[model samples]
Target: MNSRNDRTDLVDTWNGKVEEWPKVRFGDVCEIVARQVDPKLDQYAKLPHISGVNIESGTGRLLFLNTAAEDKVTSNKYLFYSGDVLYSKLRPYLRKALAVDFQGVCSADMYPLRVDRDYLDPEFTAWLLISDSFTKYADGESRRARMPKLNREQLFNWTAQIPPLSKQKTINSYIKWQFDKYIRSRMAAKAQLEAAETLPAAYLRSIFQGPEAESWLILPLGEAGEISSGITLGRRVSDRETRPVPYLRVANVKDGHLDLSDVNEIDATEAEIEKLRLKSGDLLLTEGGDADKLGRGTFWEGQIPDCIHQNHIFRIRFDPSRFCHRFVAAQIASPYGKAYFLAHAKQTTGIATINQKVLSAFPLMVPPVREQKRIALMLDARRTEAERVHSALADRLKAIERLPASILSRAFIGAR
Candidate 1:
């Protein structure tokens, strides 16, 4: 269908009655302020600078403010007065818009719109820009092949339903009340999720710091297991005519568990597969990726027969007579292990890498075999409980995130 028809269908489906209020072009009710000033200039160096990065999505809250003096902002920025509405022109799909209570200099990628107070309220217009309907409109118009952006011409030409000033105030008040409730619920869910995430780390820390830990012998990982790098892919594939065999990458290893959901295949001979293949009790650790992922790993249970791992992952075959794989894996995935990895890892940009020498040198606290088993079992149970709580809180947070648009859809349709 045509663009006009598509827009009408969207409005009717979302708001039910398009003719309930007078329709006006966005520009008719709001004046785009393009006043430019160099933020680094002496006159404006101390003023707060807003950018697309500074505003949180959906919520009109400013995340943090940076002055040109502090941030060393060198570019010309758009000047916005108090009460103006700030709309992000870059990445319109983010739906970032806010009504400011203070004067600031914003990045040129943002449009500081001053609404005609006689016709439209700034708060109401800010809400509309963040609503799903306007977001959809902006997304449609900003459909460039690459780096999609909402241009001033298209944004100004967009039409919106304008209710009476008194009605606008009432609707905005109702939306604010509902949104405040949603924000509180979201914050609580997020806090619970954070707590759940840290529980395992805390538990592990307490165990290591306990009085019993003093009796434990400290040894290097090389003393506990045979640490070896995995198969180098291209050489093995070319060495002989080989068939595709399931193999593990760094992605397959996670903290305390494996995610074999997207395991891939490689070509290798029978001898190569046997040499590099994973066993039921092998501990798999990643060499590098993000700083947090350094040395993170889990035990392998022979989930797939003849499964071998890539070079980026280190395979540790523990001596069953001396060490328990589960206990070692848990200790390596603990906060203590994380701190060691972060300190010793070779960092480039944001990525961190641990070489074979570093992995072999890992300091392991070894207890008696029976005590090791017990500790592993206890940590497993704690991790399971924490994961359950985290998963539930994550689901609640997802629902909370959708609440704002749902409330706005109801409010604009006169359903609330």
Candidate 2:
């Protein structure tokens, strides 16, 4: 197994010695061993199925597994055995390929490659397919096709250096070794990000669920403010003056944040726009989507003047003297709000939605306006800190994602 430092040392050595390896065309050491069969047949129906989507791009790793029967695969597929390299011909730029150790049925879009073991190792062949040189060639050739597909002739015609068996095995081992480390680092960073994301919830719980909260007034959200649905789009406006105006959709509202980027436009009359016009300090929530996102919302700060919202979003305007909009929005995004919305949300076909009636009845904790502002300020500070950590971790994961290409390029093409 090679360490990160060992990879660099090996690459430097390879840069000087690589030309000694016998150069050969890809077809010289491998053949596409296709055995097309109907997936509906009983013999193949029970076998695990692999498709282009199931293979992760550039990693040569399978993302998931399901049987042909489970997917109800009705079309013809290629049968592949253990130790065969599976490569997707469609969308060669995606770099989807893998070396499997179990018998399975793959989509017709993939090639079941059987390499001559004496010349090429199966795992090495899979890795070679995604090397920078191969990807560059495949991407160019595939683009020449009508649908960006690498025809069989185009794939087999590409040439490459055939390293000795010992060197081929070493390259595969080194790649897998580095990939294992990268995966572990990625998982740790993701876990840290998840924890950072939950910081706001923790802050919310501390203030809203403390012993003092029991002494505060509890009233329905409608009692503290106005809750109204936005204007409906694509409606028949008979004789009504309509014009295209910027409008916020469910996608624009995120938990505790508003993504003003790419705000879409909708046709609405003056009266509709006036009635549904978003104002500064207005709290907006999505009607529904994923169960976890049932009540996701944030305070709109009038980022876009005259901007309205779609009917799928509920606009809540609280009396400034009685309540702080920021405080109320924070409470609604807390775990308490999430639990209530999920409990009362109308669930149908894996989708959950909360209507105006359900949203109006939401129980809100009322404390002194001054106290509410203080808690909201503290929560905002914590949220800012968490966002900083999340951003750094996200950037790190992206950099890790690009490591495989660099590693593979160095191994095969001696790229620095």
Candidate 3:
């Protein structure tokens, strides 16, 4: 048996010497198995189902499995057997492909491939589809409509370079081993990132859960100050003379901070600016987009002068004498706040929204002014530390994600 390094060396030698390997069209080595099965049929209704959403990108690993009955799949699906390569034709750029070990019915948007065992290894064929070169080819050939997708003809007509069957096995085994190690490392980084993300929330919970809870007063947010929606933008420009003033949109408000990098100008009347203008200590919250962004908000420190917020954002003015705006922001971004928003928010199509009434009725935890400042200081420090860790872990995960492309490039073309 060849050692891993020995197999890698063999690949390097083959590529470096430009050894002649059989070049074949993808269709020559694989049969496009389009066994259609109506999921509504009693015979197939209870079979396990797979789709693009069920597989992770670039790893050929199944993320989830659901029965057709459980998923309530009513459309016609493609049947796949064990050891088949499942490739998603929808959005080829997502790079979703998997080698299944169980029989199932997949979405019509997927292609269940049957490999020619005498000529190609199934695992090798799956990995080949995940490579950058193949992804680029698929992207080029896919029809550019509302949803970019590859047709059967385009996929079958694509070409691939093949090594000997034994070499293919060796390379596939080596790639799998390398991928396993990479996955472990990436998972560890992701775990660390998740832990880092939860650190600030844990700290906030600790603070609120202390003896301070007994003395804390739960009051509606409207009790602190006035809450109002921002100015609404219309398709037609205002007839009144107006100038472009920097404005905050839902995109500008993040979980705990404002992103002003792409702030745009909106024409507003002087009275509209006066009524909707954001104050230095105003807290800006998004109305809704994603479910997680229901209560997401940040304090405005007057980054842009004379800036007004859009109608999609709610501007809350709090009495500085009683509450710290930063502390309010920290609380709203915490787990407890998220749960409250998730419960009260009206949800539709994965988007959750809160109206002015709901926003005004938000339960606010108020402590002594001095205590609020202290809590805000502690939370800010902890959040900064957690963000630093999260950023570093995110960068590491990105680099790990690029490793497969690097390895594939080396395996196909000689290392530069």
Q: Pick the lDDT winner.
A: 2
**Order of all candidates by lDDT, from best down to worst?**
2, 1, 3
lDDT of 1 by residue, 1-416 (tens): 23545433443443545457788898888888889998878878888888888888876667899887788889888888998999998878787898988888988888999999998889988888887778888888888637779998898888877877876776677777777788899898898888888898899887876788888999988878898888786673554767788999888888778998999999888887889989999999998989978778988998998899998889999888789888888888877788989999999998899998888888899999999999989988988888888888889899899887887776676321
Which residue pairs show backbone clashes in model 2?
none
Per-prediction TM-score: 0.82, 0.85, 0.74
Q: What is the C-alpha lDDT of each candidate?
A: 0.84, 0.87, 0.83
Off by over 4 Å in 1: 1-20, 144-146, 217-220, 233-244, 261-269, 288-291, 319-322, 339-363, 366-368, 414-416
Question: Better model by lDDT, 2 or 3?
Answer: 2
lDDT of 3 by residue, 182-246 (tens): 88998998898888877887987877666766678998888886888887888455477787899
For this target, which candidate reaches the highest TM-score against the unseen true structure? Answer: 2
| All-Cα superposition RMSD per candidate | 6.9, 3.5, 4.9
lDDT of 2 by residue, 209-279 (tens): 87878898989998888988887866888998888889998888998788888898888899998998999
In angstroms, the error of model 2 at 409 is 1.2
Off by over 4 Å in 3: 1-10, 13-18, 33-43, 67-70, 79-84, 100-104, 143-147, 212-254, 259-278, 283-296, 308-324, 328-375, 414-416
lDDT winner between 1 and 3, please give it.
Answer: 1
lDDT at residue 371 of model 3 (Cα atoms): 85
